[model samples]
Target: MATTSTQRFGIFAALALVMAATRVHLSLFHHDIWDASWGVFFLAGFWLRGTGRWAFPLLMAEAVLVDYVVITRMGISFWDHYCVSAGYWFLVAAYGALWIGGSWLAKHQRGIKLSTLGMAVAALLVSENACYVISNGSFYWLSAHVPAPKSFAAWFENLGDWYLPFLETTAVYVGLGGVLHVLAVQLARLSQHSGQTQH
Candidate 1:
């Protein structure tokens, strides 16, 4: 059997694609608090590491395509309902921040230790908070949805409602990704050991 680079990254790539698709579906149909796209973005950088430069942009492009399809084909009316304006473009920065945080954390990758888990959680929180601020702040300020008088207090209040859900969702998904990565590595090691014994 032969393995190309894509094949080598097959598991992570498949996971990323599934997560991305789920995100799109959730956005269009569910619109729930448990969004997975942000976590998947972070996982992409964590898993891809050196490949993140290209991977992050590719994922962002996927997001944009999904949003377009949702609004145009699915009759979601995201543009009409949500105040995107130029602020929507800020998602590039918001999501990029997540990618950078994940890439940085990957440099310190370790087993499922308390220290590693804490570090990952800390990084995730920072990235998630930054993403929320950028995304929410942009929408509040630039979205035509907001009336003439933009109330900073009102935005903060809305943020308070959303912030916890954002953190919880990201934490849950990232934790799951970590568990999956660890299990996959252990399974691969066990398989290799069995092959050695067979010979």
Candidate 2:
């Protein structure tokens, strides 16, 4: 759909604000829709499209700042609580994969086709699985909290246990987003046709 510069910026800004709120919720509540963190990334990428290049960094910084405040004010060690380390930086790559997948989808497809929808779902699965492996693998290998010497199968099993929640969250957000996008397009078309009839 064609959009004005102001419209594009406003949409992106709104997404950023919502994501910021979601981060705050996750930080304070510490549960109940933590998957919004993951959902927002792909949503931002899908909606922001070209602007996603910048939105991702901003959203990531927001997440990091929220974590910093939570750790500092709440009097908890992030490393101890989350088992983070230098490996935590791997999150960049993980999230980048998600962003890339969504951006690719945006560029390749305009209206949703079944084939494109399948591709989008596949992309999310691939990106989420990659994120799980990179983020969790790093934690398993590089974090001080993981007892020395872990088995691959054990790690694989652990990865499986957590995978469904992440997948479900991403699917829900993306699926809802797709539906909204379709509705918006249909409305725009209807409005445009009405304007043409008035002439």
Q: TM-scores of all models?
A: 0.86, 0.88
Total backbone clashes of model 2?
0
**Poorly placed runs, candidate 1 (over 4 Å):** 1-4, 7-12, 75-83, 196-199
Candidate 2 local lDDT, residue 5: 76
Off by over 4 Å in 2: 1-3, 77-80
lDDT at 195 for candidate 1?
Answer: 100
- Error (Å) of candidate 1 at residue 89 is 0.5
lDDT value, candidate 1, whole model: 0.77
The 10-residue segment with the lowest total lDDT in model 1 = 1-10
**For model 2, what is the C-alpha lDDT against the true structure?**
0.74
Which residue pairs come into collision in candidate 1? none
Top candidate, metric lDDT:
1
Tell me how far the alpha carbon of residue 47 in candidate 1 is from the true structure, in angstroms, after superposition. Answer: 0.4
- Model 1's number of clashes is 0
120-193, model 2: which lDDT tens digit per residue?
Answer: 88777887777778877887777777775788988888788877877887778777777878898889889999
lDDT, candidate 1, 135-184, per-residue tens: 88988888887787878898998899888888788888888988887887
Q: Candidate 2's error at 186, in angstroms?
A: 1.5
